[model samples]
Target: MSAAPALASLQALFARAVVAGEDEAVLAHLAGDPETARRRLGLYRRAILANQAGALRAAFPVVARLVGEGFFDEAARRYGEASPPARADLNRHGESFPAFLSGYPHAASMPWLADVARLEWAAHESLMAADEAPLDFDALARVEAAGQPCLRFRLHPSLRLVRSAWPVLAIWEANQPGRDGTPDREEGADDVLAWREAGRLRYALLAPREAAFVEALARGETLAEAAGEGEPWDFGTMLGRLAGAGLLCAFSRGAAAPP
Candidate 1:
């Protein structure tokens, strides 16, 4: 083989050995002597495994607690091999872990595991999402009544909406450090809206109408159009709750209509 192709195959083989916990025969072609090459390969394997485990653990502390350290460690090891981190930023790692857990054999017993992971991931994402100012009510007040139809509102950059087929909010709350006093699991689902308010991550469980209302607004529906999705949407109550919770960030007098 040409030098470039040979080197590329060697690199790929090295990565496979380290990530897949495979035999170390792949290192025989390294430039160094056989002994030196094997030692170097071993060092690379250890570092890769350690880094992957560390990142997974950091992202899923609650998962670790739920499953216990030993079980979680083994699961992390297996998952790391299957879905190695593709980015240098560890914070963005485990973005697909929630989905992974949903289908994992052991996790099937605890159907809520996936939803819990979803909630935690949402909080993590909200923390890193871009920041935006709360709605400028002052700007809205200055607009002409006739201009209301042209106005477009924007949600806060850190705002995130998650709807689950399980009681994810209750599950998350019950798992909280001091919330051990709650009753045993019940049957139901919940829709959660999370956002950063006053520099803190805050979340609220929304009713069907409320969730639909916010979802419509999120899709660029105007106050009038979005409210239309939820008949008798109680615009005053819904808007008041959202504004109070800092979900709405800013509004303009006129902008493009909803898609």
Candidate 2:
């Protein structure tokens, strides 16, 4: 093998060892006494594990708080090993943490934990999403109200809806700062809508029909088409809710056309 590829492989192996939380056979390639190599690799492993766990904690504060700091620390360490960041940006890590929790035997006691993590991830993603212009009410008004059903809408790029079978939104809200009571150990189901508006990220729980409307709009359906999808539908109320949240940030005839 060429020197460059060999060095690259070694670097990858080093990272793998740290992520695995054990096995430092790669250290054999480095120049040092055996004892010194063991000491250095052990310290390196601990530091790397700690750093990755810290990043995970930062990204999933609610999860940490829910599980308690010590439990989270050990779990995060194992998670870092099993699902290490695939990208250089640590902020992009923890995408699979919810899945990890869902399968972890220890987390089985908190079956709704994964759903809560999903909600947090959506919020985190929205906060980091790119900026965009708000929907132009003037342009939308130009279209005849009758023709509005044919008008396709584009949600803000930062908009995300997290639908869960568990009452994840309630759980998340209950854990927010300033709440004085312990959250109930019960599960409920709903959808969470998250979006960035005017440099601020916000989230709200959506009613069943409302979630369907938002989903339809996100899928590029016309206002009329989306409204038709729900019974007892009120286009006025739907538009009002969307506009109030500033979640409807873009819509154009071209983007709405069947591709």
Candidate 3:
């Protein structure tokens, strides 16, 4: 019999063993005494768990800090067992970590933990997003009033806006290094903005209205339409803010790329 099919079957079994976090099936495939094979697989499982947990720590620093190293490791292990890394790159792992935390029974008490995870993921993704050009003011100025509704503004790819019921920004900021003392732990709703500018990651907490306005623009709403979404949001002032923060990139008519 050809060995190709056997190899493929082994590969599938190995994946199941890893995902299910059980070693018996995979250990049986190894040519050794059952006890020795189990011991080796145990070591392999430990190493893989450590690696997966390490990635989660790097991606969600605040979450790890909040939960502490040991608890975080257990959580990461559980997450890995449920969802193994489908890709080789570790950076791509933990995309569902925020959602995992939200539903995790142990994390139920910390209602805002998931939002903090969201903030961390936003920061992580912003750093890796592709760079884009600054907003073209001239193009925006050229659009006629009649066509303003269709004139869509594009935010930079690296710009991420996170709206949360909890003050996640305050929690993240307090955990950051080099603070003079404990941060006030600012409470209440917030719209946290994260973006990479000049190779540095920038974060800010925005008011609800401003958040609404920016979110609308990010969704490809026209300048006129976006302005209407946020109560008391000043378009001219926001325009300057977008320019200063380097968040705006290009404009489009009906979501089509501008010429």
TM-score for each candidate, following the candidate numbering: 0.82, 0.86, 0.88
In order of lDDT, best first, we have 3, 2, 1
Worst 10 residues of 3 by lDDT: 1-10
lDDT of all predictions: 0.75, 0.77, 0.82
- Model 3: what TM-score? 0.88
Among these predictions, the greatest TM-score belongs to 3
Off by over 4 Å in 1: 1-7, 29-43, 144-151, 178-185, 252-259
Which should have the higher TM-score, number 1 or number 2? Answer: 2
Write down the TM-score for model 2.
0.86
Alpha carbon RMSD to native, model 3: 2.9
Candidate 2, 130-240: lDDT as tens digits = 787667788777886666667777777788998888878777777777864266645567788888877787888787778888888889887677776435566678678
Best by lDDT: 3
Error of 1 at 5 (Å): 7.8
Clashing pairs in 3: none
- Candidate 3, which segments miss by more than 4 Å at Cα? 1-5, 16-21, 144-150, 179-181, 229-232, 254-259
Residue-by-residue lDDT tens digits, candidate 1, 134-173? 7668867888878675566677777778888888787777
